[model samples]
Target chain A: MPYPEELVSPMRAELTRLGVKELRTAAEVDGFANGQKGTALLVINSVCGCAAGGARPGVAMALEHGTKPDAVVTVFAGQDLDAVAKARALFAEYPPSSPSLALFKDGKVVHFVPRHQIEGRAPAMIANDLKAAFDKHCAKAS
Target chain B: MGTFHHDTHELHGITCVVETRGPRTWVGRVHEVGPAGVLLHDADVFDEVPGGPTKAEFLARTAAVGPWPRHKSVVVPAAEVTSVRRLGDLSA
Candidate 1:
């Protein structure tokens, strides 16, 4: 059954407030994933304990690093069904996982963080993992 | 496993979304679409989106979405999409 709007809205807001764009439909996912517009950070958000306790906070802190993606966007799994399906299309080679993080540059999957990585880890540790990806993929700001 | 690593440009050819059906059918959005494993965002509501049901009630009433395995991200085709919306800069 569809998740009520109430439970997912705050999670959406939390990501939105952090400047994370919400891809609510398939076209939007294509628009963001199709073109080579620098690096984009795609966060697969969830409502699990690990997400609240680790993933979300880790994402916020990781963005604080000097090197980062040009854009950061997100989608909720159970709620935005079509949108999530569309976004996953961009990762043609990889399998699907929730509460994951994928960094794309020039429209390619450069780095990925699977669910296992987020389940038990602390926010700080997650941030460190993301920061390391940023260092390797993100372009240095001039 | 080992620490995640790769070039950002390497993601160009992959799909960023995947469609999978199980006990509860729904789509997954790829937060980070890459070769390693895609990050999926499953939509849900809990005292947020207007007209949505309450969290407590939602949990009590609805079945969980899935039991997706670890270390895997699905690839969705672009043709299945219906629309796209930008949350920020509503004017955009």
Candidate 2:
């Protein structure tokens, strides 16, 4: 069952407030990939205790650093099926993962955060890990 | 056993095209993607309130979409997903 609209607004607001762009359709995902000129971060959002407790907050904290993707975007796992599928196609090397994070540089996947990384961890811990990845991949330009 | 993962905070937005036991399939966003059972937000196009409580209610009632209650949220089984993508990123 989909979430009630009332319920979804608050949740969507949380991600928006954190600076995560919502890719509601496959075309949007494609536009992001093709239109964006630089590194983009794609997050597959999910409704799980670990995701609430760790993943989203962790990604938010990680983006606080000096070096981060030029753009950060997300797709709700079960909600935006086509968009999610399109994004996964970009990740040719890795298998599909929900509640996962993928970093692309110039339209190519450079980093991937699989499900194994999200389970059973503190948000801070996940943030730190993401920060590390950001530091390595995200350009220090803007 | 298939493994699936979900970020703790982005729990509300995840969606997937789930395949059931027989030859059934549907696309819906996840209200709660846990170990017990994925709480899907069914996309009802005809409803007056396209994104209303009916969506949640339908998810709660749908039987063709699950293995019946998950245990501890983990990585989605690779077999369950045909693909994965981002809906959009919220602007920071």
Q: Which candidate gets the maximum TM-score versus the true structure?
A: 1
Tens digits of per-residue lDDT, candidate 1, A1-142, equal: 5567787787778778889999999888877776658899999887665567778889999988888999999988777889988888877465566677889989888987765456556889999989999999899776
lDDT for model 2, please.
Answer: 0.61
Model 2 chain A: lowest-lDDT 10 consecutive positions: A3-12
- At residue B38, what lDDT does model 1 achieve? 36
Kindly list the per-residue Cα lDDT of model 2 for residues A1-142, writing each as its tens digit: 5555564566556677987899989999888887556788888877655567667778888888888888999887766679888887888556465677888888888777665456556778878877777788778865
RMSD of 2: 14.3
Q: Count the backbone clashes (under 3 Å) in each candidate.
A: 57, 62
Real contacts recovered, all predictions: 0.02, 0.00
